[model samples]
Target: MDFRRTSTALTREQKLAVVSVADVKAQERITNSYEDALIGQYIEAAYDYLAGPDGWLGRCCLLEETFEAYIPNPGGGFELPIRPVVDLSSITGFEVSDGAGGYDPVSAALYAKSVNEGFGYILHSGQSSWPISIGVDPRRYKVTFKAGFGAADDVPSPIKLGIIMLASHFYQNREATFSDNRITAVSRQIEFGLRNLCGRYRISRDHS
Candidate 1:
């Protein structure tokens, strides 16, 4: 093995680092299916919904903002973060719910609309890098509710399942025939951009 030669294989240090990150991500993807607890069932439902051509699991269908992540997805990178945009000015229905920390079924419904609006911002806004810049774009989420009973229960079991299943993709290892230079270049960019944000969250560019 020529250590100095720039072959397709990763160097010893590079491979180890990538493997470590990949392992952590893989653990997250593991679905606890012993008694079909919090994760297993949810993932199954997502797969079921995605079984058909119109399952609405692809990039355009469900996700509105997807560029840097999907455009040049990195190694051990399957778990994708999708943000949709919803216009506060247009939403005409129930009160808007903000799931900043967390959310239940009802909150998820309203938040989903808001996320779609963010997606629209990404699609049109060409000033920034891609999805992240757009997703972070300042937008308002409306909360409208009439004096009535607990908001309509649109939180179906199938939807929950899909969410779980969609998350599973993150654990799976990706195989690329030809490694692209962009992966390394993008990681460098990530490292540079996140230098200031490091103390808060651990961010590094170790794409092998």
Candidate 2:
């Protein structure tokens, strides 16, 4: 996934600070353009993997996007998915369309005060009938929302540290992998370190 933040969470100076390398020429061994690019790549990858609709760990912010949810046709009625959504900061818009081509905006009065529980929402106004779309459309309901911690500063300390640690590890071991693509000790160490941070914001099995 493409990250909204274009640069690494940790700055070049910050990476150098982490390793205590002050000389510009010596630091170029790890802070060159190619290495800087790799560091940024790893930072985004870690952020994406940890702050998830899938994996769990980091905090994110200033994100806004639209998502679609398909209403399932059961013999009884429509059912929404109960899984914990990833990085769903807030649901700003909820609208539905009729199978034929008409659309209607769902009123907030029909549901609770917009509380997001377990990354999903449940209407509390006792209304069960939502907009429906028939035929082959998988997503009849559209939701626009934002996710993340709010800004880079708001990200948890552990997650930021994890990103720094992992990026530094990769930066130091440019040739950690072999021609056969074998993982190196440095890679394993960073991977192991990341595991320690993965559970920070994990969704529980019983989340509601």
Candidate 3:
């Protein structure tokens, strides 16, 4: 449905409509959902980087040895800083704990999540996984594919060329200037990566 475009000027109060707390929370959820999905993408990319041509699952444990701080989003939500575990050099004793405890799991988990989201930047050329073409300004393309997956309730990643075209906008912009395809593909990759991660999540396996 087309929203009516009103150019009429409104008072400051009218312009600044107060959003209810519920609405704010809902918006936060949506934003966080996207960010959470993005995190998955970073994880996949990092995992791929660590794994190379061979399967990624086997090398996940290496990250634990290099445990580091988690990096949060620019504003809020996540709260982990980026730091290699190697940089940490202040341990005085080496007692054996019941559980294989080394660096903080919570922080490491978050860091691993972020790296997964950074994968899109790595696989999106005209040759990697998808032969999807992207112009200098990819916002102009009309293809879509997901480099990762999000929550379990999340929808399936659209890998079809038709969906990719539609998502990228075979003809128009859905959200911003970034080709509709790019966003959709990016979203799909993130969702698929995370969704399929249950049995094969790199971080968990590595840490375990």
The lDDT of model 2 is 0.45
Candidate 2, 1-208: lDDT as tens digits: 1113222344444333322222222434553454445555555554455544444542222122233444432223221232223333455555666656655676665554233432545344655654445565544554444454444454556666665665555455565455324467645766777767644444444431
Rank by TM-score (best first): 2, 1, 3
Q: On lDDT, who's better, 2 or 3?
A: 2
lDDT of 3 by residue, 1-208 (tens): 0111122322222211211222332423433444443333333333333331133332222221221221211112221211111211211111111122322212222211222322211112222222222333212111111222221122122211112222222113324545454787766764464435422343332244
lDDT scores for all predictions? 0.27, 0.45, 0.26
lDDT (C-alpha) at residue 92 in model 2: 51
Q: How many residue pairs clash in each candidate at the backbone level?
A: 21, 5, 38
User: Any idea how many clashes model 3 has?
Assistant: 38
**Would you list the clashing residue pairs of candidate 2?**
52-86, 53-86, 60-148, 60-149, 61-150
lDDT of 1 at 186: 49
Worst 10 residues of 2 by lDDT: 74-83
- Regions of model 2 farther than 4 Å from truth: 1-38, 48-89, 100-102, 113-118, 131-136, 176-188, 204-208
